[model samples]
Target: MKPADSAAVALLGLTVLGLAAPTAAAQVEPDPMVAGQRVRISDGRRCAQDGAARVSSRLFGPVVLRPGEGGMAAQARVAEGAAPGRYPVTIHCASGGASFTETVTVRDARVEGLNAAQAAGGLALLALAAGAAFWLRRTVGGRS
Candidate 1:
């Protein structure tokens, strides 16, 4: 092959490799979960130290990250009553002070429909109040 042709082939190979290989930006992963749901993440990067690993969010709670296998596993529970929306997740790597941030979406549980337990409880409370009111009216009115 000609020198120029060889150069072109090398450039093409580099471009293909660049597209095929996953970059650092692609390594960070985001897991989406509903309110009160648990999400697990498996990360392959090792941090600087044990205490250096951290994840945080305001809507939910702190992420419990543990070293496992060749990487790390993170467990985070979404707040039971957290409002449906996108929340920011911040991950702190123990090594090199590197941080990663991603957004997780929380879908409203109520969006599906009314919860049976909540509806039943509300109805029961309403009936009890009505019965108490009837009793009060009968007694205070001096009626049988």
Candidate 2:
């Protein structure tokens, strides 16, 4: 083939691949999940076939991924007494015929609660100061 024709063919092939990329991307589902939460996996068109969902976790060995409508679902359970951190979770499926790595974050509920409480307390303190300032301005200006 002529050089110009070959270049045109290459360009056409790239364009086609780019157009089909989104369909392939739809095959991968949710990622960066919270520990112990069930999340779904997708190959875009349908759920993983039976006995096709396999999961491996750094902290929890051999996690089970159940087949569900549209995809496969798996819950990355944090190990008992494990500290809060990011852990790797690997998912394998037949539809995509590939493995994907997602991170599961294990956070202590108590710590989250405490952080929330601290934020609320700070907001309350600011509100109180604003109110006090407004009161002082009214009283002092009335005397002037």
Candidate 3:
């Protein structure tokens, strides 16, 4: 092969290897989490051997992260009044390791239509009204 062609091949191989290199990333489980719910954040790389790392976000506030299987894991409870939107979560290692950001989605807990409790209550009221009508009909008819 020509020198120029070999050089080009080497450059292409290097570029591919660089692109395939693994990078430390952070991710949140249960992407669309309801407000007041807890979510698990997983770290792709372990933090330095120092104190605990800090995980903070507008939805969940600051939480101390600990090293777990595969990487660091922490559970954060989203605020009860968090608005329905996407929030950025940040993980800062204690010993100045790489910091990464991940996004978490928060959704309103209340459903748009009637919920189970409301449906049950409505059924109870309906039954009571039916019973009252039956009693009135029986009593008035018997008297007449």
Worst 10 residues of 3 by lDDT: 2-11
Best by TM-score: 3
| Residue 37 Cα positional deviation in candidate 3, in Å, after optimal superposition | 0.7
The residue-by-residue lDDT of candidate 2 on 1-144, one tens digit each, is 643445457556756875776554222223333445444444343334666566666656575566666556554444565567776666676556677665645565532234555679677667755665665566557741
Per-residue accuracy of model 1 over 15-103 as CA lDDT, tens digit each: 68757986332122333357777666444464543653767677556665567664656666667888878777666776546776667
By TM-score rank, best first, the candidates go 3, 1, 2
- TM-score to true structure, per model: 0.49, 0.41, 0.55
Computed on alpha carbons, the lDDT of every model, listed in order, comes to 0.59, 0.55, 0.73
Each prediction's Cα RMSD?
Answer: 26.3, 18.5, 24.5
lDDT of 3 at 102: 81
Model 3 off-target regions past 4 Å? 1-24, 109-144
Kindly provide the TM-score of model 1 when superposed on the true structure, using C-alpha atoms: 0.49
